[model samples]
Target: MISHHLLLCATPAKALCCPDPAAGQASWDSLKRLVREWGLEDPARPEGIVLRTKADCLRICAEGPVLLIWPEGIVYGGVSAERVERILREHVIGGTPIDAWIVKRLPFRPAAA
Candidate 1:
């Protein structure tokens, strides 16, 4: 079972979000590496595996290198390589979100079937 989905806007086609595309790429790389290293992809885990996607643009263009965590719908801004670990350890693994870095939160609202 997949517990969470992390969507990171790293390389936007227009470069409107991040002035430097390299920084965005770095954040994406960090996210990819950490997710694998932390074993968040293990389907057998109790919390379930975490899936990650590199989004070209998340539509919140002001905050470059933004990250969006699904289900919870927590959008974190200014996501750099240095911040990836804490976000994973505190929010992804520990089940607690870091409010400080959170830019916006749009809770999941699935339509009735």
Candidate 2:
């Protein structure tokens, strides 16, 4: 089962979100490496696997390279390659969100299935 979906707005269609696209790509690479290295994709683990997506734009224009953690709906801004490790370890695994980096929160509200 999938535990969480990490949506990274790394490459926006327009340059409004991130002025430098390379920086965003770097962050995206970091996210992929950590996710795979940490064994988050292992189905044998009990906590479920974490899935990541490289989104062109999340529609939040100011926070270039923003990371949105779904279900809990934590939106983190200014997510550089360096910050990706901390987020995965602290927020994703430890179950505690870093308040300082958080820019917004939009908890998921699923409609009746």
Candidate 3:
């Protein structure tokens, strides 16, 4: 049996914030295709890919639709349908997190609103 190895971050709140869920779905759909094409889901492999969409607050509301890669602890923000394909194909499959879209951790402060 192969162990799962991939996580997708998607919260309902975050998804609601997206300009279009269709776009988000499209993005996720493409990544799924790549995972199959890359042989990340082979049952005979020692490890396999897993995509998870979580429903917790990442605390980056300004940057909705965030994705976090576990073990490596990398977080990406402001992701769209178009960019997700490249991220999965080049970064996730390639064993490198996409830094260009990373969401840097920062001190949290309550909004004045």
Candidate 4:
């Protein structure tokens, strides 16, 4: 069994940039490239350095391009191609979560009468 250290929870919509799979395969391809560039499969590293997951819904649709880092439980949102580099260079490689792009969960506001 491959023990993955990083897990990317990607949805089909993320690939299409749409809510469904009809968005074509471009999104999936982009993500795959990122995985490779991140050196997740390096043999010298831990047994399972990285893994990808196809999530039906992570409940953060508004925040497309979201990825979750396990063990730490840090959820990153609104990720783009440009940001991937920083995420890898700083977060994944540096062992720290990037606070600049982090999606802050604000408290729910009640409707006023």
RMSD of each: 1.5, 1.7, 7.7, 8.2
Per-model TM-score versus the true fold: 0.93, 0.93, 0.63, 0.61
In what order do the candidates fall by TM-score, top score first? 2, 1, 3, 4
lDDT of 1 by residue, 1-113 (tens): 88889999898898887888999999999999999888889777889999999988888887878999988999999889989889999998888999999999897677899
Model 3 TM-score is: 0.63
Q: Which ten residues in a row have the lowest lDDT in candidate 4?
A: 16-25
Question: What TM value does model 2 have?
Answer: 0.93
Instruction: Give the runs in model 2 whose Cα sits over 4 Å from its true position.
Output: 110-113
The 10-residue segment of model 3 with minimum total lDDT is: 2-11
lDDT values for all models: 0.90, 0.90, 0.58, 0.56
Clashes of each: 0, 0, 4, 3
The collision pairs in model 4 are 3-48, 4-48, 5-48
User: 1-113, model 2: which lDDT tens digit per residue?
Assistant: 88888999997888777888998999999999999999998897688999999987887878778999977998899999999999999989999989999999897677879
- Pitting candidate 1 against candidate 3, the one with the higher TM-score is 1
lDDT of 4 by residue, 14-106 (tens): 443234342213334455677687677666666455665655555655555665555455666666556666776677667777997776443
